[model samples]
Target: MDLMALIQQALEASGKLRDLSKKLEDADFKMILADLHSALADAKLESGELKIKLALAQEEIVRLKQVIEQRDKGKPTYNSEGVYTFEGEVGRFCTACWDSDERKMRLTDLASEFRFVGQWECPKCHAGYGAKDA
Candidate 1:
């Protein structure tokens, strides 16, 4: 059974045990005692089952996390060059390329081409050619 179901069962058993203890002074206490014992046993078994299920769930979570980390490690990283290439749909473009001779054209100039190359604002134009721009 699932963790939630086991927990609910355990809680119900505990409540029943409390009620049984409250009536321990009555003549029918023997019958209630037997039922409480059975409930206690069931609660213990359910608790063990919950522990096993939690361990399995934790193991799977760790495995999935490792898989994600490995996948991210395999991906390409972009540095100061600002150029990155990926295997499929993912790609990175040099932001400075927009201000260079290679990208003198603008969005308004690319009416026929129907495509914009590099970033919207030229990094070179904003930062200048060297650190002096700062």
Candidate 2:
């Protein structure tokens, strides 16, 4: 049983013992009552410690869930042009790399002198965007 339930039962039993003691004047009964009270006090202390641990565990679970949600939200999504948007941020990503491997292969703009101007190229896969390869 859990510490809380055990502590609660101990408390209830202590109350019943006290009530029963009032009807008897035996010395042995009084000694037993003293021991029961001591044990109940110890149980109460242990219950408090268990409650703190339970609270800490619950807090950790909440923190881990929040971290997972943030990671999933940061994942990129594909646009109509087959490029992935970086968590809604500016930047055209390689859809092939991201969709196939979850790798963020950013596309770099080709220079005007390269004939591939206004196009983006994947640094990792060497794939070209816009106008295709001549």
Candidate 3:
């Protein structure tokens, strides 16, 4: 039986045992009933703990689904120079870093006075590509 069903049955048995014990006058029978009630109480408590853990597991599943959906919506697209654009975002990223390592490393503009001026360089892999002049 499921934990919840077992808990419900145990609680019902405990209540019935209590009612039966109240009508009895023998000390031995009363003591046995008391012990059974205590055991049922422990069983119910353990089942409650399992129920809480089950709820937490369900919540974790929902959170993981949300992460997967977000990743799907934001998956990047790369161009010929290996620059990438994400959905609904303005800036471009380095495709070398993303394609090779799945890292979204942004490209930095090359030093203005350098030979590679007007180009962007990947901070992660040191790859360079010319900027799109828009």
Candidate 4:
């Protein structure tokens, strides 16, 4: 039915064949060989079916992934310029007080640039904003 089931069936058939080989002198050796042959045939058939099922499943997964990518493409995204505009007010205030007040202000004016600063505060009033906290 599935790849795993087919593999298990193949393993079971192999174990039976091993057992039959170990007991070659037994009276039912011929019958065991016949049963092993039948099991091997079934395993082969199951493996073929499993291969087809896996191929179909992989195709479906690819199709679904493409659909998801297309859906995401339609979603809105904030540009670097837009973020700079939105945070301009705070950045400007920090720059103005960078030298006058000394509360440790670390602000980046360029939104396109990425940095790992811990804190940003206004030197004049010590008012700060933590982007990570947000």
Best candidate per TM-score, number? 3
Best by lDDT: 2
Indicate the TM-score of model 2. Answer: 0.41
The alpha-carbon lDDT assigned to residue 4 of candidate 2 equals 70
User: Per-residue lDDT for 42-77 in model 3, tens only?
Assistant: 887887888899899999999888767757777798
List residue ranges in candidate 4 displaced over 4 A.
1-27, 75-134
Better of 1 and 2 by TM-score: 2
CA lDDT of each candidate? 0.51, 0.79, 0.78, 0.53
Task: Look at candidate 2 and tell me the lDDT of residue 104.
Answer: 73
The sequence of per-residue lDDT tens digits that candidate 4 reaches over residues 76-122 is 22333221112322343343343343222434433323223324444
Checking candidate 1 for backbone clashes, the offending pairs are none
Using TM-score as the measure, what is the rank order of every candidate, best first?
A: 3, 2, 4, 1
Model 3 stretches astray by more than 4 angstroms? 1-6, 23-26, 68-84, 87-134
All candidates: TM-score: 0.37, 0.41, 0.43, 0.38
Which 10 consecutive residues of model 4 have the lowest summed lDDT?
Answer: 80-89
Q: After superposition, how far is residue 42 of candidate 2 from its true place, in Å?
A: 2.0
Q: Could you tell me the lDDT of residue 110 within candidate 4?
A: 30
Per-candidate alpha-carbon RMSD to the true structure:
11.3, 10.3, 7.5, 14.4
Residue 26, candidate 1: C-alpha displacement in angstroms: 5.9
What is candidate 1's CA lDDT for residue 54? 87
Q: List runs of model 2 lying over 4 Å from the truth.
A: 1-16, 19-25, 74-134
* lDDT measured at residue 38 in model 3 versus the true structure, 0 to 100: 83
Candidate 1 lDDT over residue span 1-134, tens digit each: 86557657766766776676686666576566667667766777777888899899999999888767645645444445344333443434333443243332111122233223423223344322112112
Q: Give the higher-TM-score candidate: 2 or 4.
A: 2
